[model samples]
Target: MPARPPAATRRTAVGAALLGLVAVGGCDLDDLDPRSDPAPGSGEPSEPPADADADLVETVVTALSTALAATSAVPPRDRAALRPLARLHRRHLAELGADEPVEGGVASMTAAQVRSREERLQRRLADWSVQAESGELARVLASMSAAVAQQLALPAPRPRGAGGGS
Candidate 1:
């Protein structure tokens, strides 16, 4: 029988054969059909169709209103400071026409907790706005989101008698 090639020679031969196959496979010019390319305008990114959830929007508004109302337990000065935010939520509830009864009672929370809740609500509104089907509703949600974000960026109100002169 003829002596088999050395292991190294066999490996080199097999590697060369595989490399030749890859090079040939990569030269398939027929795969570049222009007709297969995405049509003009079709490939351009577009916003996903809105999936409006009216109930969800209503629920968010209610939760925000309740949370703002719960801030009454905070010091009078602090509560007063939060009044604008509360009013905003009230306006949102009215605009959203959130007449559905909310089941739960408001939970007592500190001023910091209230701020955190507002931040959370703002984030939710922003996300919902992206999914809202109605352009007007989405715009409203976006506006509210910006308002809440702006409020969050502001320095927390100093508690009465906390170092500043009376």
Candidate 2:
């Protein structure tokens, strides 16, 4: 009969096997390194991601900027309440730390383009407000504004490709 391995050798072999298993499973080791960009001619279909946060920010900024400018005046209390919201928007965008400024375009964008996009949204919101019945106009604006406000208030940008959290 073959001689059994000594207890110490048996333990060492088991330890080595376990170590190898862990190394194989660990995230630190990769089939493809994440640090590298996707290969050219990979022929994988990948759409550029939507800039939902930036879009919402631009919409709110444009709509609020235009509406505030267009009105003869807003009540002092309403204006005061709006101040923090505006600040929040700026702070959130700053936190996003996007190298590019919030140009309306996903790729390169300029301030003028951003402003134009905002203006368009502002007009749409205004028309919707006017057409709404039973104070629905105010409700719609308030709801959209609130949604943007909530998104702005988040502590960090959502991860690059999916889902959200504070």
Candidate 3:
């Protein structure tokens, strides 16, 4: 009769098996971005993926559009600092094949209001990232979320010579 392995050895084997399963499972990426080039010789399918998830795509697009609008509404003092961030949102929209978002509402907002809007947008994007249906879409959403969070984390740029004595 074969001898049973010790408990510690059995636990180690089970742990290793679970870890291997995780490693393999992580590789299942249907990250096929519709915008990406065709695989090998497959020139092009009749139509692009558009999105495996129409709802998710629309949600992301709308969220970004709203956020972009907020940036536009920021008081002039803050717009220069926020220009790169606005551009980032536009790039994300472009990646999703969305046109530049229409600007509506709020010609200008107080600094505090702009900050609040950005914070809300960051949270919404983060939530949508994990909920996304496609792995590539998930990554894109997460990237946008991270970008927003990073922008928020940064100290607002100081006006030249404004901080010398303060």
Candidate 4:
């Protein structure tokens, strides 16, 4: 592995990255989405986001994959509610320039399982985002983490077209 940059250099890189992101007037996935014309992961290897610390990205990927694995444990009745979160994790993986993860075997997802996996993913994303060498990468990771938190805080989504009594 290449020697990590000195602290001063890393800090400079982080600052420059943030400045560049600010110059563009955006910081979320909208500006960072790479899935335009040719498609996001068109079998072509993508360059890691600006000075993204390889180790940090790897950690995020692991967390994401874990969350995806948890998806398989979702009970049949709950699959509809959890499906979107799984899809989002897949998108997050793609945004990180990572390959698609294999799905886990089917099993019943208990409330404890959902809470444990999702919260762990959120924790890892938040913690690693802070240590990211690239401000751009950090921002993206933080956003992903926030999305997880938002989803977990909300009531489980009802199946589409399932309405309550008038």
Tens digit of per-residue lDDT, candidate 2, span 70-93: 221333323443444445344433
Kindly list the per-residue Cα lDDT of model 4 for residues 86-165, writing each as its tens digit.
88898889888789887774366775577677988888887887887666777787777766766676667675456876
Total clashes in model 1, counting residue pairs 3 or more apart in sequence or in different chains: 0
The alpha-carbon deviation from the true structure for residue 143 of candidate 3, after best TM-score superposition, in angstroms, is: 1.1
Model 1 pairs in collision: none
The backbone clash count of each candidate, in order, is 0, 0, 0, 1
Q: In model 2, what is the error at residue 68, expressed in angstroms?
A: 18
After superposition, which runs of candidate 2 have C-alpha atoms over 4 Å from their true positions?
1-105, 134-166
Model 4, runs deviating above 4 Å: 1-52, 105-108, 157-166
Number of the predicted model whose TM-score against the real structure is largest: 3
Compared with the true structure, model 4 gives a TM-score of 0.61
For model 2, the local distance difference test gives 0.39
Worst 10 residues of 3 by lDDT: 21-30
Candidate rank order under lDDT: 3, 4, 1, 2
lDDT of all predictions, in order shown?
0.64, 0.39, 0.70, 0.70
Q: Which ten residues in a row have the lowest lDDT in candidate 2?
A: 26-35
Task: Order candidates by TM-score, high to low.
Answer: 3, 4, 1, 2
